[model samples]
Target: MKYAVLIGDGMADYPIEKLGGKTILQAARTPAMDYIAAHGKAGYAKTIPEGFHPGSDVANMSILGYDPAVYYSGRAPLEAASMGVTLAPDDVAFRCNLVTIEHGRIKDYSAGHISSEEAKILIETLDAELGTDELSFYPGVSYRHLMVARKNLGAETECTPPHDITGKKIDKYLPRGKDGAFFSDRIKASMIVLELHPVNLKRIEEGKNPANSIWVWGQGHAPKFTPFQELYGKTGAVISAVDLLKGIGVYAGLDVIEVEGATGYLDTNYEGKVNAAIEALKTKDLVFIHVEAPDEAGHEGSIDKKLKAVEDFDSRIVAPILKHAQTSDEPFTILILPDHPTPISVKTHTQDPIPFAIYRTDNKESDEVQTFDEDSVKKGSLGLVKASDLIGMLVKAK
Candidate 1:
């Protein structure tokens, strides 16, 4: 038996008056996903456990059958694992974002989704100007960078993710705690170095959001996880553009496949990811494919773009993979769902349970759910289950 899990990150949403009171998932055309819902079992999965923040790090961990309360260290450590940045026992890894701050407000979390080439230069300059024996910067994709502090800093410091503070004044959300003063100084110092840099100047000239400052948050030490194969007794692989998901794959002991043009945005290489999954499943027992376009659209508060992203994911990614699984000689099970809800109304993630569906090529039995949306799946026979139960249900059935 073979298995594939496709995640449309942050695809879930609340109803909007603009789309005739329909959620993005409900409004979008997702025939491929709808087919799975109609022909297979569907249900809601609570990816975010109680007392946990609605972050992708925690949610994806849950989806992979790992309990976040036990395995989740912090978002950055996982990304660090993917980047091959080793952390000592005392080091704390932080997600360093090159953000746009204007008029004392957090204007753009991703700094207009700054190009990786440009961001690499900016991060290098920051390291030259501010890095010391204790602190250093490492560049990843786009604005999602990293910083390592070689000290055992307590995690009590309150730091707000820039994406969550979009369009809001950042003064109240600035880092606050025992280590707040040091982080604040570093953030202010980065602005002085980046504000006049050629990259920011050129961006401003082009009427783009300038990445003028570095915002640091999501810090933790390294984590350990039993390999996916060991836990489930199946060879597994993961594909994603974001370092965070790739990082999760790293600790989970799965092969992290990198596609040529896979960006974590609306313009990502959708077809290439589909092709990658198909090839990986030829040898691996399970493959996890994560698409970040819908989530990016949600963060930008673009309803039209989000709707288009959803449809593209269904047709370009879901359709091709489902077709391949159906034609394969061996029996296969495919699961589809989002990590969390990036609701258009709030322009951020929520802790609500997400809808999911699993289609078995060898089983003819199915539930009555006919559409793959937030509301319709509630009537599915599979009902509500913990996200951790998904992998067990899929692999154990085989």
Candidate 2:
């Protein structure tokens, strides 16, 4: 059986033009997605669980058949993996971010969109000056980066993520350690010095992002995954809008291919991504397409942008897949789901269950439904689901 899966970001709600901005799903015209819900089965599924701050790495891993409970570290090590950074057993890692704090408030949280070249230079400089047996800086996407190998150094360190968009100060995250006062102070002090370095100021003047603030958090290590060759007897491939997702795919032994002119931004090759998935289906047994525009737009608090992303994904990917399924005689089954609910209000992925659905000839009688989304799916049979259960459902359908 051929399986096609489309993983959207956040499929949550927001105030439409009635308030100020357009709800992401409402703003765009998703004729294709509309066709899927109309012709195929549509329902809501809890892709994430409560209490856990759901992010892309854990959520997608759970959805892709791997039990996240068994294998979940943090996003930092995945970033390190994507960049080919090796991790030893004693090494500790954290997701590092570049932030601009103005008067104790985050002015430019993403370090003004730091590029690879600028980060590489700054990383090299930091390594030259602060580089030691215990200290290291690994560059990642924009403000979200990684720092590793702090063993035998100290403990009681916390990370200040500039995640809170309009908060008074950055949030501190420390997984676990023995000392609180001693190690925390040293890490805080070192980061403060990095924030005020003269080298970063030069970056600001050059119209590039400043590596002013180093907000390092997300304490986690490596996670093991069961290879698809062993589990499903076929190789798997992955495509994602985020580096961490790509990193996880690489770790799980998947072939990573470019979507062709993908910018990893809003309005990023929407139809192109779907077409790329379709093409990959011919060669690869399993394919994953991740879209981040919805989550980014939600965080940006741009309702129109978020809605457009959802609508476009439906039209460009959902509708086309439905049409193809009607004609193709291959073993085809389609699954559409979101990692978590990134409400426009919080602009982050909540543990809330996002929408989901399955369409196939085998379950056509058992899975007849219409109108997808959270509210509409509640009226149907598919109830709340754990992150680990999605793969089983796919297997059963096949």
**Model 2 off-target regions past 4 Å?**
14-23, 26-28, 152-161, 171-211, 320-329, 361-363, 366-369
Candidate 1 backbone collisions, by pair: none
Which pairs in model 2 have colliding backbones?
2-331, 24-306, 24-307, 25-307, 32-319, 33-314, 96-145
Top candidate by lDDT? 1
Model 1 lowest lDDT segment of ten? 149-158
**Residue-wise C-alpha lDDT for candidate 2, range 1-398, written one tens digit per residue:** 66777877776665455545644554456666555565556666655555445677678777777666667766677777776788776566767666666665556656665665666666565566655777687765545666775662322344434554534554334222553343344345545666656667777678765656555565566666777567656566777656677777777787776675454556577777777777887888777777876766766666667777787677766777777766777757778877777777776567766667677755554344456665555555566677567656776553
Residue-wise lDDT of candidate 1 within 1-398, one digit each (tens)?
99999999999999999999999999999999999999999999999999988999999999988989889889999999999999998998999999999998889999999999999999999999999998999999989999988877635667888889998987788888978888888999998999999999999999999999999999888998988888899998899999999999999999999998888998899989988888898889999999998998999999999998899999998999899989999998999999999998899999999999999999989988999999999999989999988999999874
Give the poorly placed runs of model 1, Cα more than 4 Å off.
none
Model 1 global lDDT (CA atoms, 0 to 1): 0.92
